[model samples]
Target: MTWKRLVAIAIVIAVGFVGTILAGGLLPSGLASAQQEHREHGAPSSAPAAGAPTIAAVAVDFKFTPPEIRIKAGQTVNLVLTNRGAILHDLIIPGLKFHAAAEPGKKGTASLTAAKPGTYEFYCSVPGHREAGMKGRLIVTR
Candidate 1:
């Protein structure tokens, strides 16, 4: 594309994005409401599934409190991430496809079933957070 045409396209895209935000169309209605509720009340009050172990985890400004967690293979793990810092934090276990995000002073939850025994790294995907030491290790034991 020509330079001028590219610039015009960029401007149009930016304008559309801004308009969407201003019109409160950034997220769908159900998601927005759920997000609001999550921010206000943390995770749901429902009980954990049978035979699943609930592991409490906390995230701070630059690190996860435990820094590491240990669980068993062939077991389902329920991780609860609580953000006590002044910013958002999230837990992501790559291979497990498990992710839980918590806003400041709020909480989130996710479940992962580790089928093998090994070490898996968990980190916050937030920009610069992992580099700042916001990460931990999940040690799955057989």
Candidate 2:
């Protein structure tokens, strides 16, 4: 390539690298504080205690009471599922590989001991539930 073209390409690559770093550095302090809050709340990005259990929240209808769940490895998961819907519903955590069915005017729960850390998908396995857009993620750290 021509000397000028080569110099321009190099500058572009340099600028891109710097831009990424700057953007990352410029991320809001809220994000950092949020991470700190997680740490303070005992949410580590690694294996959970051997007997410690994770808490998962399930949604009802158009709302996810607590849209996200985070947990350490080797911990038991207590999936607290509430049905805010007027009809029966279900919440399935694919990563933890479990499901809980909820009936109207009642609460439901599914429990599991998570030995591994990874991302999980949750969906209403109840017939036609997922088709109504009842689904979310269950993340396990590591």
Candidate 3:
């Protein structure tokens, strides 16, 4: 029946909208805020601050390319991650509280400004990935 099909479509739309709303509400404010600046610049850009250095990183089956990142204290770093793996992957710098994630075959970006010179551990936050060797270090120099 045409009416029955319309009702089903309406329900599906409503459920999808509610799910989107709930998912948005559940994310941390910082993550949600950064995600809001999405633009179609041929690709997503995190728009790092002036003079910031942009670094390209890759994520494979269970490892991160390069395995290390270096930056200068007081300088902002923009990182772009491309997921070349067959599963979801993410980048999380616990100390700096920076996170960037890309689903399989997708790309993601994040920016971090380290005001202190030190070594910070960065890794993929996805469950079990870190233990499988998805960890690295972010060295900040003065």
Cα lDDT of model 3 overall? 0.79
Question: Weakest 10 consecutive residues, lDDT, candidate 2?
Answer: 37-46
In the range 1-142, model 3's lDDT, one tens digit per residue, is: 6999999999999999999999888776745444442211123234555666788889997899879988999888789899999987788776776778788999887778889999999877665677789889989999
Q: Considering summed lDDT, which 10 consecutive residues are worst modelled in model 1? A: 38-47
> Sorted by TM-score, highest first, which candidate order results?
3, 1, 2
List model 2 lDDT by residue over 57-123, tens digit each: 6557754657667777766766667777787666655555465666776766556656778777666
lDDT of each: 0.79, 0.62, 0.79
Colliding pairs, model 2: 48-73, 53-76, 54-76
Error of 3 at 89 (Å): 0.4
**Where does model 2 exceed 4 Å of error?**
1-58
Error of 2 at 11 (Å): 66
TM-score of each: 0.64, 0.55, 0.65
